[model samples]
Each structure stands twice: as C-alpha cells, then as structure tokens.
Target: MNKAIKVLAGLLVAQLLVILALQTNKPGTTQVAAQPLISVNLNTVDTLRIDDSDGGQVTLRKEGDRWQITNYGNQPADQNKVAELLQKLSDIEVRWPVASSAAAAERFEVAEGSAQKTLTFQTGDRVIDSLFMGTSPSYRRIHVRANGSDDIYQVELAQHDIPANPESWMDKTVLEFEGDILSVNAGDIAVSRDTNGDETSWKLAGSATDSTDPTLINTWVKRFNSLVVSALVPAQEVEPIIVQNPALTAHLSSDKGDADYAFYTANEKYYVKRFGSSALYEIASYQAKPIVEIEAKKFMLNTSDAEPPQ
Candidate 1:
C-alpha cells in the first residue's frame, strides 16, 4: 500500500507539471508584445497615393494647410477622412507575423506587383512609408506587408477602409452653406425672413403674410444649410452640361454672400453647379426635388387646408 501511494503521488506531480507547461508560453513562441507596424511622422507627410490591383489609383496632397485630391482636379479632400486614415495607419500594431518569407508574401498577395492594394506616404518626392495590403483573413483583418520587408502581418484594416477612388476622398459637403440664409429667389418664387421683437416670420412672394406654411419654408432653408452632393462631375463633361439650359436656377442670399445655384438634368441624373464654383456636382433626385420644385403656391395654404382654432 505504501508503494502504491508513492506511485500515485508521483503521477499527480507529473500531471500538474504538464498543465503548467501547457498554460505558459513556450520558448520560441511566435506571439510577441504588440508593436507598431510602421513608424511614420504624420507632420512630414504631404502626399498619399493608393494603388489597387485593377490599375486604379488616387493621390491626395496637402496644399498649404488643406488636403486636396490631386488626381481629381485638385478638389478639396474631406479632411476628417484623411486624418482618420493617417491615424489608423499610425496606430496599427503587429502582435504576430503571419510569415516572413518572400514566397509567403506572394501567397498572401502582399508582394509588390501582386498586392491587392498598396499605399504610399510621401513628402515631396521622398517616400515616407509604403505598405501593401492583401487578402483579408476576416471581416476587418487584412494581410499587410511593408515595403522592402518580407514580414507579413494581419492588421485590422479592410480594403474598403482605404479606397483608391478619388471621389471617395472628395469633400462631398463642400457646397453646404455656412451662415444664415436671409433670402432665396428662384424665378418668380421668392422667400425672405424678417424679425420683429421676439417674433420671427417668413414671407413668400405672391402669398400674403401669415398665409404660407412657415414649416415648409423653414425645412427648405435647413436643406440649404445641410446640402451634400453625391460626387463631382468629370471635368470633360462639365462644359457640355453647362452649355445646355438649366432646368432650374436659384439665388441664395446669405451672410457670407449671394450665390446662385443652377440645377440641370441629363442622362437621368441631376446636377447642380454653384455659380462661382468651377466644380459641378451630381445630386440625387430626392435631394434636388425640394429645391427645384419649390413654388410660391406650394408655400401658400388654402382656406380649406387651415386647422380649426383650439
């Protein structure tokens, strides 16, 4: 019995040792403390270019203090989007390298000339950092390999996050108004605002005071403040469309200045051009409907449409 007890105790010790070893990371384990994939000084980066497998590319450059999409006619870039991308790239950390061999890079589709996407940061002509992104392992994790490095890592960046399309980087809300719009005129339809004591009122042309729906006019003014276009029309298509008669023209008087917007419809797409802007934008039909269909009579309420007194 004493011998049997001793043997049982030895077996228990062996089992405990195995459990401890299994729970602890072994020597030569691939797991490592998280470290930044690329060290980039964002302030020195003035240009960013992205190339895709389909041979499409986009370049964004910093001009003065603002960012512009250089390939897309120097259109102002959405600053927030640009900043977010730079921040994400700077913050990506590598915990474990999936592979470090040249063959593995090609197999993962992160090698040069075979990568699904490549992004480069530059200061003038000098390249700051370049990275290749390829097949995603999961929804938000993609295989990435830095330029001149065979080590490939899986990072939390999807292909759609870094679009190679110039339009995706454009400032879609560039035409939105910044200040209070005091008045608006579109052909025979006119709307203006007035303030008396603590009361504010709106006037619609051809409609008596207090006869028009103030809510409708207020909504229209709000739309002007929050207008966002779908995308800018190509430069080559601008002259042809502008030469044709516009379907509607509206004048907006604001604290900033008076500006005119001409709306056109061609190829079943709605387009709007701010009189002073060189870029023409394509607008959705739903967004253009309120502005283009505005009429003085629409704002005026008929006697039967009035609500009974409380």
Candidate 2:
C-alpha cells in the first residue's frame, strides 16, 4: 500500500512540471506571429530615392529646413511635393491574400525565393519601409532610403486630357498715365538709328521706386491697378523699332542722373536728360547740333497689359 502511494505522488509532481513548461513555451509562438517585418513609419525618415518610369532616378536628402536632391551634388529639392508623396505611402492599406493558398501566392508572391524585389528600411534599432512586387509598365518606381533601410514606391505621369486656358491667371488692373510720372529706374541702354529722317525708340526701366510724391505715387498706383483689371494680350502685338543711321546713336549721360532715356528714331540716337527742371532737354547725337525737343511726350500707351492694383 505504501509503495503505491509514493508512486502516485511522484506522477502528480511530474504532471505539474509539464504544465508549467508548456505555458512558458506558448508565449514564444504568440510573439513570433504578432507583427509583420516590413511595416514602415514615414514621418521620421530624412532621405529617400524616387525612380520614374522613364528610367530616371532622384535621391533626396534633408538640409536645414529644406530637402534637396543630393544625388547630383546638392541641388535644390521641392519639399512640399515630397511631403505629399510620403503621406500617400503611409496611408496605403493593402489587402494581402492568405498564405500558401494559390490566390495569395499569385497576387503577393509572398513565398520565399520569389523573383520580385523587396524593399527594406531601418533606423537606429527599428526597421520601416515598403516593397514593390512588379513593374508598372507605364509608370516608374521610386526608391526611398531612410534611417538604414530602402523603400520602393511607384509613380504615374498625369495625362493631358483637359485643355488649359492660358489667360485665366492674368491680372486685369489698368493704370491711367495721365497722372504725375513717378521716379523711373532705368536699366542698361542700347542705342540704334533708322534710315528714315524721323527717330523714335523704346527703353526699359525697373518700375519699382521709393519715392513718396503724391503725383508720382498716384500714377504708379493707378498703373498697377490697371494691370490687375486687364488681361494680357497675345505675343503677336510686339513690333520692333527700326534702326537706320549708326552716326545718330551718339549721346552723353551722367552716372548720378535720376532718370535716363534712350531716344532713337529711324535716323538718330539721343541720350535724353531726366530729373531737375532741365530734364525736358534732349541731348544731341552730334556735338554740332544744339539741344532739341523740350518735354517730348512723356508717356506711351500700351494697348495690351496687365498688373495687380497698388
């Protein structure tokens, strides 16, 4: 009787030990099946590679507050555009088929040793990124590397199915030149002459200035307003002034002159004076000729122009 009791006690102790061992081993299996290896977090990455369908590739890196294309030795990159792409990638939720089934194997190619290329991403101690299974015939694939891993992405080119109206974005404001002429900032001058007896030409000057004169200020303000109110004309309206006599192009100018005008007609070149009461005088192209034309027409009309109101 005693021997039988001892045997029974030993069997019970052995069964308890076996149950504890099983419990401990169960946790390992649950952890292994909990998450996938390829999941990625898009926000913290500082570098990325983007490939297009045409076999072109771009690599970008973050510098200061901007992202630049570092693959070409530090070129500027469009950060806003890149951010939009990253957001799209993180939000994608793929519906992968079940493992081992024919449908799953065919759609995702998840089997080991598959032909498709896989993308990997790592940072410090974490791995994050995405994978591309097949090539998109029309669109190209882009690779992004952040932290320590690589991520693959696909991009498509937009089609021009809709026509765009070029004039839609133009400002329509108009300015009346009848008001006081503001200070004009003249740029470099080019002199030429025409064959005909009459001489006429055009000059370009930076329209911006710091003057506060009521008349000058009002004129520019109106001009800027007109530009905001009017649509720009097509390019066909531009016409070139004719140059005739090279001798007529001689003129004199002061470096400190407030305003400078290049006057040329079909036959002569004149450097006209601007600023002070004497500004109305036109400097003769030849030393023998006296000053001519006081206060020539100060303003010209533009049939087609546009700008924002001041």
Candidate 3:
C-alpha cells in the first residue's frame, strides 16, 4: 500500500514538472528578438531621394531649419511625414537575410520589380546609404536590398506607409487666406466684413442681408479655414489643363497681398485655382458645399445677441 502511494506521488511530481517546463518554453517567453537590418546616423542624412519604380521621384532637402520638398518647387515638406520616414530607415533591422544572389532578389521584390523604390540617403554630396525597398512580405514588414550588394532582407514595416511620389510630400495648404478673405461672390451670394476692425466679423453683403441668421456666414468661415487640396497639380501639367472661368470666385485681400480662389466644377467634383499656384486644387466637398449653395438669410445677427444679451 505504501509502495502504491509512493508511485502515485512520483507520478504527480512528474506531471507538475512537465506543466512548469511547458509554461517556460511558450512562444515569446524565452526568445530574444533579432537585431536591426540596417543602421545609420540619421543626423548625418541631410538629403533623401526616393526614386519610385511606380512614377515620380521625390527629393527632400534640409534647408536652414526646415525641410523643403524640392521637386516641382521648393516649398516646405510636411515635417511629420519626413520625420517618420527618417526614423524608420534608421531603425529597420533585418528579420532574416532572404537572398545573396542577384537573381534571388527579383523573387523577393528587392530587384527588377515595378513596385521597388530606391531610397538614397546623403549628407552634402556624400552618399550615406542607398537601399531598395519592395512590397511588404506580411503585415508590419518590408523587403529591402542595399546598394552595391545583392543581399536582400525582410524588415518589419508597413510598405505602404512611406509615399515615394514627389507630390505626396508637399504641404497641402495651397490656399489659406480665409482670414484675409474680405469678400466672396459665389454666383450671386456674397459675404464680407461689415466693418473694418479686430472686433468686426463677417456678414451678408450687397443683397443677401434679408434676416439676422449668423449660421450662414459662420458655416462659410468654418469651411474656408480648412480649404486645402488633395494634391499639388504637377508642374509640367499645370498650364495646359488649367481653366480660367470658375463656377465660384472668392476675392480675398490680406495685409500681405491680394489673393483669390476660383472654384470650377467638372464631373461633379469641385476644383479650385488659386492666384499663386498654377496647379488646380480639388476642393474638399465638405468645405465646398456650404459656400456654393449657402442662402442669404444665414448672415443675420442672432436675435438674442442683437437684443444685447440681458
């Protein structure tokens, strides 16, 4: 009986040990992650050129204290986008080396693929690093190949997050003169400041002032503040495709200068041509709808406020 009890105790001890061993060896519990695929001093990289196999090449240059998107023109590049790209390039380390042979690179999409984009990092004229990036192998991973070598590696990153196109890097704020927009004549509807001072606000002008509803002018101002384009119309295509007469025109005057945004409609989408940019900007529908069809009664001063808030 005592021998039987001893054997049962031995079996229970073995079962406990097995459970402990299984728990210790579980995935991610005892593993160290792999090292980075590529390493570089991000500060040393002053200029970045991304030549996409898809189409246009984007060139970014750090000028003075700001980064300039210098393809079609030298305007400020979106800093958030530029900063994220640099950080990813500096931090990406290899998941595993996929291929060493040049022929093997095509299978991994690091070479001879239409989707491949080459990122060239430079300090002054000296090349810091040049790498070819391909499509994602899986979620949160990208395939890469270094210059002057055939070694390809799959690294952790979303391939689609980085935009290789030149126009995508541009600051989209093409027209931001809403504060300076003294008056606008959209078809027959017009809005303007009734008086000239800091305390003065917008009201219906010419013939729209039938009532005292402030909602109309307030809604127009709200939309005007956020007026920006989907993308910069490319430089080469600017002159040929642009149109003069717009469906709506907003004549704006600022302390700096006089600027205007003329809105044109094609196939139901609203496009705007500003004074400075040769490129026609597609107007966001949320902003365009209110101004295009806003009624005159909307500019009225509130009855409660007009009565002098008792």
Candidate 4:
C-alpha cells in the first residue's frame, strides 16, 4: 500500500509539471503584444501606389490637405475614401501570424512575387511602407505580408477595399455646383431668374409670341444644380474632343460665380468640359439627353393650340 501511494504521488507530480510547462509556453499567451503589420505614420505619407496582379494600377498623391489621383490627370480624389483607407492601414493590428514559411507564403499567395495586390506608401521619393495582400481565408480577412517580413497574417481588410482603378478614387461629384442659379444661356435658349424675390420668376429670351414652357425650362436648368459625372477624361485625350466644334454649348451664372460647359460625343460616348476645368468629364447618355437635345421650339409654348387665351 505504501509503495502504491508513492507511485501515485509521483505520477500526479509529473502531470502537474507538464501542465505548468504548457501554461508557461502557450502559443499566444505572451505578455508582449503582437507588433503591427503596418507601422508607418499616415501624416508623412504623401503618395500611395496600388498594383494588382492583373496589371492594373492607381496612384494618389497628397497636395496640401487634398488628395489627387495623379495617374488620372491629377483629378481630385474622394477625400472620404482616402481617409478611410489610411485609417484602415493605421488601425490593422496583427494578433498572430497565420503563416511565416516561404512555402506557406506561396501557398497563401503572399510570397514576395506572388501577392495578388501590392500597396506602397511613399513620402517624396522614399518608400515609407508597403504591404502585399492576397487570398481571403474568410470574409473580410486578407492574407498580408509586410515589405520586410516573411510572416504573413490574416488581417481584417478586404481585397476590394483598395481598388486599382484610378476612377475608383476620383471624386465623381467634383463638378457639382452650389448656390442659387441666376441665369443660363445656350444659343437661342436663354433664361434668367429674379435674384431678389421671395418667389423666383424666370424670363425667357424670346418674345410673348414665343413664350417658353416654364416646366421644360425649369427641368433643363435643374440638371446643372447637381451635376454628377460618370468618369474623367484625361486632358491629353480631350484635346481632339474639345478642339472640334462642340455639339452643345451653355453658360451659367450663379450667386457663387459664372462658368461655361461644352458637350461633345465621340464613339457613342458623351462628354462635357467645364470651361475653366483642366479635364473633361464623361457623363451618362441619359444625363446628356435632356440637356443636349433641347431645342428652343421644344421649350416654347404652343400658343396656337391654346383656346384663344381664355
């Protein structure tokens, strides 16, 4: 009985020792926190480059507080979208590495040259940081590897969140105007609104014999109130489009200022250029139809059809 008791006590001690050893060296129980995958300060970042495996690329540069899509004719970038991307880069914390071996990297698509997407951040000419992202282990979780490290981690960023298309970063509403519209002139179609009145009244350029349809005029004028373009045409590509006689030309005066717009069509695609803007804006056919196809006769009231002005 005494020998059996000692043997049982020895076995219990060995089991306790093994448990303590495992508790000390557990995989993720270290006191030190996991280092961040991306550690560059966003304020110092002035340029961003995104490249995808499919040969698509986009570049954005910071000028003052505004961001511009440098590859897309220096067009203004969507500030909110840029801010969100920067915030995501700064916020991603690496809890644990899903992989670190070279073979593992190749299997996960995060190997040095095998990554699906590469994001590079730069300050002036120096690259501040870069990351290679590939393969979604799950929804919103992307396998990422930092520039100088072999350890690849699955982070909470989606692959589509960083688009390689320049248009995805451009501000589509850059041409949208604000303030009260004062007057509009388009060849024979001219209209002006009363600026100093509680109720706004519009006067057409033609005589009473050529009275205008208020609804049609109002509808045509409102298109400018909140114009949104579908895509941006680079300045180099727009020269031929602009040099030719435009299909339609219109000038507008607002409380804020005055501006002119020229519309054109090439290969069945519609385009518009604001007189002072550096680039041409591509608009949808539906958006251009009502404005470009407008005729003075269409807006003029058919008084002959009226019942003798009863």
Q: Residue-pair clashes per candidate, as listed?
A: 0, 37, 8, 0
Q: List the residue pairs that clash in candidate 4.
A: none
Tens digits of per-residue lDDT, candidate 3, 1-310, equal 9999999999999999999999988887855466655556778778988877767588899987678877756767878888988787777665457778877777666774443777788888888877788867788888888876777887776656666776678777756664545565566666666436332466666644445444446556556556776666556655544544566777655445566777776667777777666667666676666666555544555443332111
In candidate 1, position 169 carries an lDDT of 95
Residue 237, candidate 2: C-alpha displacement in angstroms: 34
RMSD (CA, Å), each prediction: 4.3, 19.8, 6.9, 6.6
**Can you write out model 2's per-residue Cα lDDT over 65-164, one digit (the tens) per residue?**
6766554435444455666655655554433222334344334432223413333333433434534343333544322222222222233322111002
lDDT of 4 by residue, 1-310 (tens): 9999999999999999999999989988777577767888888999999999898899999999999998888889999999999998888888778778888888888776678999999998899888998899899988999888888898899988999999899898887756678788986788887887322266677645347656666667888876778898866788887778888898999889988888899879899888876679899888877788776666667754322111
**Cα TM-score of candidate 4:** 0.81
Alpha-carbon local distance difference test for all models? 0.84, 0.34, 0.68, 0.83
Candidate 3's clash total is 8
Please, what is the TM-score per model?
A: 0.88, 0.31, 0.69, 0.81
C-alpha RMSD between model 4 and the true structure: 6.6
Model 2 Cα shift for residue 266 (angstroms): 29
Sort the candidates on TM-score, descending order: 1, 4, 3, 2
lDDT, model 1: 0.84
Off by over 4 Å in 1: 1-31, 195-200, 303-310
